[model samples]
Target: MSRRRPRASFAIGTVKVRAGHAREVGLPITRLVTGADVSLPVHVVHGRDDGPTVWINAAIHGDEVIGVEVIRRVLTKVSPKTIRGTLLAVPIVNVLGFMNGDRYLPDRRDLNRSFPGSARGSLAGRIANLLMTEVVAKCEVGIDMHTGSDRRSNLPQIRCDVDDPHTLDLARAFGAPVIFHAKLRDGSLRYAARERGARVLLFEGGEAWRFDEWAIEAGVRGVLRVLAHLGMIEPVEDEPPPLSLICRRSGWVRARRTGILQMEANLGQVVTDDERLGGLSDSFGRRLRLVRANRAGVVIGRTEAPLVNRGDALIHIAEIEQENETPGQAELAEPSE
Candidate 1:
């Protein structure tokens, strides 16, 4: 007879979860004006065997709801008994903003800009502090999910500090259509998590406040790939993943003139420098300005709204190496609205 290995116990906030089981834990934030308590809900899956602990959190920005579904699907596919390490998933991190359907808290502060927060500070600060202490501190690796802000939509992409070998490995393992070297902004969760000795990957996909099936599927698969790369669970597929285009630099092309903008290129499309990307024209079809690509690159993000103002960002392009050129089918035939 084989001897059974001892199971581990994982605790967060006031909740405790034993190995081979799952539990929902709530980290209290603050009460609403109506006297209702708002808490950050976290789902924990502790594996029987010890390995690397990974934390996957979504909706740090409340309006980015696609990650909520991504997290849900990931949880449904993951079983605690088969995993080797703990999985801490917080689908909704900003409960106040999530409830209000706003990007920022009622106090009008961006939670992503208030990381490593103070306990006695503003609302965003307090929530950030709580997450840093309770969730991020306990994990070895983290995935922060996000979507394009305002009226913009993104091609499913992975953004991380590729300079870090460990983070770069996870980014490539994620198998997104593209991977860009994104610098960390001060006070952002990625920055805070890195400072705490955890490698982090930031995934940007689809648009805010709506679900994109393609983006959601990509997100779920990418996360599972990372987990398998960490030996937390079995791989979803035995075959090698499709190659991901890696870009070291990217920039946005803003509307040169305010008008009704018409795009000639779609997201994930590759264009050469000086190629016509779009045109801004008046309602009567009088061309006001012809938008051209400033440099040769792949379109990773673009605004969905037809109406535009001068200086408004219209297309985001990332410069990739020749060897990492994207396949023709990787480009979308139509823009995602």
Candidate 2:
């Protein structure tokens, strides 16, 4: 007869959640200007059986709030009672920046770049340290959710170390429209988690500060799919998952002449080299320059802001083979500058 593994308790900060239950705990951050203590809220769901522990975190960049809605919807569909593992969900990580609708901490430091930080460091660093110690250290897998920066929109995509077999499998199971071979950025949460022996998948979709229904729905579905792949939940057979287009490299098309930018390309559009993507025109309706594709690729991201300056990134394209590239064997590209 097979033996069942013993159920374990999940603890973070001062709260402890045992098997087959869910709990919400607040991890203290620094105080505000008004001396009010701010805390990072976490929802933990611990299943009755033993399985892989996973964490889903959102709002590392406070302005990219679509992930918050995605996490909420995902939690609504998940319960600890019938699952086989623990799920840690943190809908808001940067409380200070989230409250102000800003992208960076009050100290102007980017929280994403302050990972595995020190307790005696800056505000962002301290928060990073807290998350690494209290949340990330306890998980074997993680999914960090994000949307594009302000004035930009991204197609639903999974970005991860595609060369790693296990990480690549999770990325494929996520079923995003695109799978990007994104390398770890210095000091980023993915990098830190990987250093601590955890495999992480970064999900990028929609735009900052606003919830896009398609992106949110895709994200919710993808998280559930990953959980199912991890044996934490039953498979969701809603629809056949989309085939992920793998991209080795991506480049940004920048505006040549500063003017009112009119983009002709959109997310998910395929373009060839020298294809006209847009035209820049002045306020008087005189065309200054025409933007063309520098390489053959599909549009994965684009700027929404009509007004642009010289060298401003106007479109993002991911380079993929028209044919012959197999899944899990695609080449990787260098991290974007």
Candidate 3:
């Protein structure tokens, strides 16, 4: 019979982040600087354990930085002594955009749009290739954190192709009150990973270039809970998780007429097609162009900026049937992680 390989272990300063020492460990992925063998800023935190090797990566779009911060806090408090398998936390995947405070690479290409990446292509494509090979290829489970575009904010939510059995369990274990289960897009990180037989989850919240404490806390705690479900972490006694609503359908509410927008509802609130979500006005607020939802559902996400144009995406909403029921609302407990 074949034997399993031994697990590797390590420590980080005062924190004991082990891969199998006890449970999981977080490792720092040292990066090499551009045009030199020297390294740039990049890191990972690995937990020690015999469980699954799960990777949580964030900041694919430099301006969408909440995940970077969220991963940082998760590392500070994750006790390597408690992890059962492995946890790899990568906070900044897009170094160039992160450093320059731009959403796209210097080539002006959306990094997230390039997946499985090009081994020989533009800077963004190259980076994507490196991650697919070195980081994601090694992981059994992955979570890519994100936020809405610079113009919008997203409520705390978990999105995945939940039709998959394993993914459905994860979306539930995440415990967010809102869930969007759908298909994968071409060339997305989720698509590439699934092709490799790894199930991944995408956590969306807040807006690009801005931070939401509530959303961050929700994300950190949700990830920990998922670890528990995967046998990678100890199960701690906790309050009942928020009841989740599955929105099998979601779409953008475009601007019918170009004008400045003033939103009436915040992210997470429910909306209908007949009701006014927000309205548009001339630069002087004289003539108004109203915006409305195309279907009935929750306002899981929306734009943050006031500027708008006809057909410009204003809100990214998630919905079920017009009469589909949802759980009663109870304020989510404060994030403990």
Candidate 4:
């Protein structure tokens, strides 16, 4: 009987580390619809030795620019020579949206919702199709980065379905505080990735079209921790921040009446029942509505749009069982790295 060598799943192609041409390790899926020949940038790292493969991506929503910065730092700092198995990093997915500084593509389609994509569909759908077919179908794991839209800010969090133990493992390993354990939306990248037999963790932080230093630091460190956990690199201490607990349920506290808005509770602030989140007022300074937390939990997301309709979501809250789970005095010895 002849013995055969085990195949490396990420060894789909060789990465080009040359000048001008950037890198094109993976096979070309499709040329983007730009007037110029400039296409999406993809860097595939298939290490000489076999290990796990994790693809980290950012800017699915073009307005969410912090992840783009995060991926840039991660790619530049993570030497492929030191990487073990493989790391496929795509800093920007929605090129058109990013260029226009809009949340959706020119076609008004959300790329995140258009995935696992269609080759013969709209522009965003085509890009989604490319990612689903070419990149995601070949990866073992993934990390999709995101942020809150408009003036609303998100304290760094991992949002995913916690029903599966394996998915939970990856989420924990990713090491972001405050997880929103919720059901997967139909067309989200998480559902698409899961359909492709890979578990992906979505990191939500900061605000769209803005930069938050702490959120960016949390994102970059979380990616590094995930990479370390996947055995792509040796484990290194990150001086982990306060690891907020998992939140199983969340919803929005809508504006009770229409008027000018002033927010009280901030992102990541735990709110007890009946606590005021914010208050709405008329142009004449008369109070219109007082936003209150219906349940006790942390504020995961909110809307920054000052003008609001009666039913518009103003404050998004996540209900958690462990409201008091922050790192204690004994655990805060100069913040271990």
Query: Which candidate wins on TM-score?
Result: 1
Q: Which ten residues in a row have the lowest lDDT in candidate 1?
A: 326-335
lDDT of 2 by residue, 68-153 (tens): 99999989888989888899999999998999999999889999999999999998999999999999999999999999996998
Question: Model 1 compared with the native: what TM-score?
Answer: 0.96
Q: Say which candidate scores most in lDDT.
A: 1
Q: What's the distance in Å from true for residue 11, model 1?
A: 1.1
lDDT of 1 by residue, 118-216 (tens): 999999999999999999999999999999999899998899987888888899899888889998899999999999999999999999998988889
Q: If both were scored by lDDT, which would come out higher, candidate 1 or candidate 3?
A: 1
Off by over 4 Å in 1: 325-337
Per-prediction RMSD in angstroms? 1.7, 4.6, 5.0, 4.9
Q: Please give, for residues 139-212, the per-residue lDDT of candidate 4 as tens digits.
A: 88899999988677776788877888887777777666687786788888889898879988899888899877
Better of 1 and 2 by lDDT: 1
Clashing residue pairs, candidate 4?
A: 117-129, 239-337
C-alpha lDDT values of all predictions: 0.89, 0.88, 0.73, 0.75
**lDDT of model 2 at residue 41?**
91
Q: State how far residue 62 of model 1 sits from its true place (Å).
A: 0.8
Clashes of each: 0, 0, 34, 2
- Candidate 3 vs candidate 4: the lDDT winner is 4
